[model samples]
Target chain A: MRPLRRLVLAIPALWLFAFFLAPFALVAKISVSRPLVAQPPYEPVFSLADGWQGLWDKLSRLTLDAYALVFSDDLYLDAYLSSLRLAAIATLLTLLIGFPLAHAMTRAPRQWRTALVLLAIAPFWTSFLIRIYAWIMILKDEGLLNHALLSLGLIHAPLSIFATEAAVLIGIVYSYLPFMVLPLYTALEKQDPALLEAAADLGATPLRAFWRITCPLAWPGIFAGLLLVFIPAVGEFVIPDLLGGSDTLMIGRSLWNEFFENRDWPAASAVAIVLLAILIVPLVLHERQQVKERAA
Target chain B: MKRGLQPFHLAVLALGFGFLYVPIALLVLYSFNASRLVTVWGGFSTHWYEALLGNEALLASAFVSLRVALVSSVLATILGTMAAFALVRFGRFSGRTLFAGALYAPLVMPEVIIGLSLLLLFVGLGIDRGFWTIVAGHTTLGLCFVTVVVQARLATFDRSLEEAAMDLGATPLATFRAVTLPLIAPAMLAGCLLAFTLSLDDFVIASFTSGPGSTTLPMRIYAQVRLGVTPEVNAISTLLIGFVGFILLGAAAINRLRKPQGSG
Candidate 1:
């Protein structure tokens, strides 16, 4: 490339290197270091200020106690499992709800389709914190739902829905519904209707046609929506923090508590590394799929 | 081929929209509640909104968030636009894969990991955690969104105009300045708006990076909401929702206007 073009690429390239890629390297380094009680709260296992020999010496002496603790402890294991389970469940729920909504959008009048799409995605552009906060208001005991239920004489008392696992699930589904619907909508909308009509003309039932034609075509959308919701939902912090009960354990929340509440930077870094390892599998698979799709 | 709307589809649409919007509508409704109790509506009043105006800490944090969003979004847009140009125009280059990975990873990476990792990097470098640190963190996050937006626009871009400009003896830089910049300006603006909203809405990253006095509005909201729900928070959230909603609607309108007829 010419010098000007090289310069254009180098600026962002260098910025990402320094800010994005380098941070993970730091996290990996810190995860192997010892936690301390001093300022910054971690023993520096390797430092650039040290000479190559000294750096080699420190690196050789680095401890894996943080990772050991993360593995040996059931708390960390449960947190990881819980996070994965919750994310999986939320992804499934979102798909179930999103698929029909996306289908409905594709079937709507062409003039109304754009407006409907806008309505569906508009909430996402608003503050995420506010959206979750909105749930807190609605789900709390004596909140709107309970108030309405009681006024209608449906129940004798308010339901204690706030700060529960169910509430967290509700929050996740609500917050991530758009992420699920948009991709599914895109995928569903692109499919040729003639294929489905041809199936019906061949005497196949609507259900059979949907299963054979629609579902197969929507697989890409399903996969995309699943990852889009599952990946972030696994690492979600604010939703569970605000909506979940005290006993709720998520890897993201665990990492936050380890770093801020306990001030154990090394432990927190270890948890983060493990979480990244788990997420990398799906992310890499998704990348390979995208590359394959592009090539095709 | 037009399919008539079925009752099942109508029900699905109604229930789906209801699930998505009922909570927000309730929150907006209760923001004007006269009662201190959120659930019990005494009468329609704007007392909570008035109270928000007088809260000093909230106002201070709002100012901080606005400033951070402005600076970081602008920085993100410039760098992101350049990155988009590199990706679209420069077909193959050394480190292209790595560059693309780094740019797109932040979009899917969880905020906590990003926050924690960035904080550790700042601490490792002996840099103080404050306004600038938050800016750096947000700029990293925002630039990715900007890049995605601008990249989409660039992919479908018409290059004939630029070729024509070059054929007329306009230098590459001159052509870019006169033709390319104006054409992609809308996408860049959209990207900047997206970045601004991301920065403003961010809480976890700001909490991790902020020092003594650099609390953003989301951080402030999180702190208060954790203590307990209050009408004042409802008021602030309602205002933010309204502001962001207006901006998004405006963006959609602009996007619609920019499209060629019958294309959308």
Candidate 2:
């Protein structure tokens, strides 16, 4: 039994350690290095030039230039801020739209619950890029939405929605709506029906019962949904790049440009490390909360 | 309790479904457009599908993406099942906290960070970026999700059945292979499907790790979208959607047939 357990644990442990932990440490190490014109395009902060003392000298070779550059430049700052802002707004919007849909699912006939739940997840079965691309076709100036508006005589000019922050918001909300909805539905679905019935028997209005009973009970779902959407949205690249104009600067794009376009691997690592830094507190809190939940 | 959906709930659900489906519907409708322009529908035609058949680069990328998705998803599922088994069945082991943290961290870690970190690791190790790198990135990304899913199934499994088997003087390995494997096979299949879909849909990690002449389908589609949408894109997208929809529905049908009535 012991040998079997060891074998079961060893393969995955080694794999994740090598591919996951080591890479993350590499990010931290490389973020402190200077940009160079080489194959990997970054100077190694460590070297073995003259044995022990050479290693000490190699440590000194690492610089704070990348972190300093991020702080000094407004581009990186704005990218961080806008990513948070867009992600926050998108989270709120998805919650608003997703709440009703999830509520509707819980209220759906029990016989249809599986189908309804499947409906919520169906979009995900398609290629994510195509789903985002579909929005581009619908929101572009000469796209379907504008065409409908024009035919209805509601607008004389095409709406400039395709390459704007609003477009990015639309794409984010669209892509993540299921993430927001599924958890909320699960939370809502699991509520004891008798509790809501008891609330009703006490003469609470339906809306009041929802707020007083459903919302309070579903708080965990809301938090989970928010985390699901916000964390990924903040670092989302494909949606903003496809839907957003130059005005929409986000950390994901910043990291990509520094690595690929600007060829500054260290700078890109800095952006990612900082992005992770900003998110770590919330992430840690969430994890701690999960641990507590599991304990209870 | 109400016996049926309220009018208000129906309206909201209708609107939500419309929002979800309309864009996809439009894409399907335009796939057959005779006109090259996205908005202008000249007439119905299959020209774009024919063009898609002729696009060798796109075909090659799709093939690579398929092969990558297949290999990585299988590897991820195996690794993920092991992780799930260790976490659930084994008592606390050395480095449990670190192992658990490593498992959960990737769940919310941004693709940019994961991609960058892994790419740098590959470069640091002098491993050239290409097909193997994309598989490595995707396997890392999908491992957590598969574990989460398979762990859910493991949590609900009837453990005493395995216990009974073991009590009959069967070795743990024999018990697992003979009893547990068949029972959890459905969940494993589901987990594999999820890992496959995740690998297929990935763009950021794939883009970061992919090298010259190794473009995946998403990479190809993203490059083409930047140039502007053609009917060809819509045709290919519709086909992809159809293929995925078939898989999802088929999976659902299987689950429906197999599921016990009173439980989730």
Candidate 2 docking class: medium
Q: Which pairs clash (backbone N, Cα, C closer than 3 Å) in model 2?
A: none
Q: Would you estimate the TM-scores of all the predictions?
A: 0.96, 0.96
- Candidate 1 chain A weakest ten by summed lDDT: A287-296
Interface RMSD of 2: 1.6
DockQ list for all candidates? 0.69, 0.70
lDDT of each: 0.89, 0.88
Q: How many backbone overlaps does candidate 2 show?
A: 0
Which whole-number lDDT from 0 to 100 does residue B229 have in model 1? 76
Clashes of 1: 0
Tens-place lDDT per residue, model 1, B52-110, is 88899999999999999999999999999989888778987777777877887787788
Tell me the deviation in Å of residue B258 in model 2.
6.5
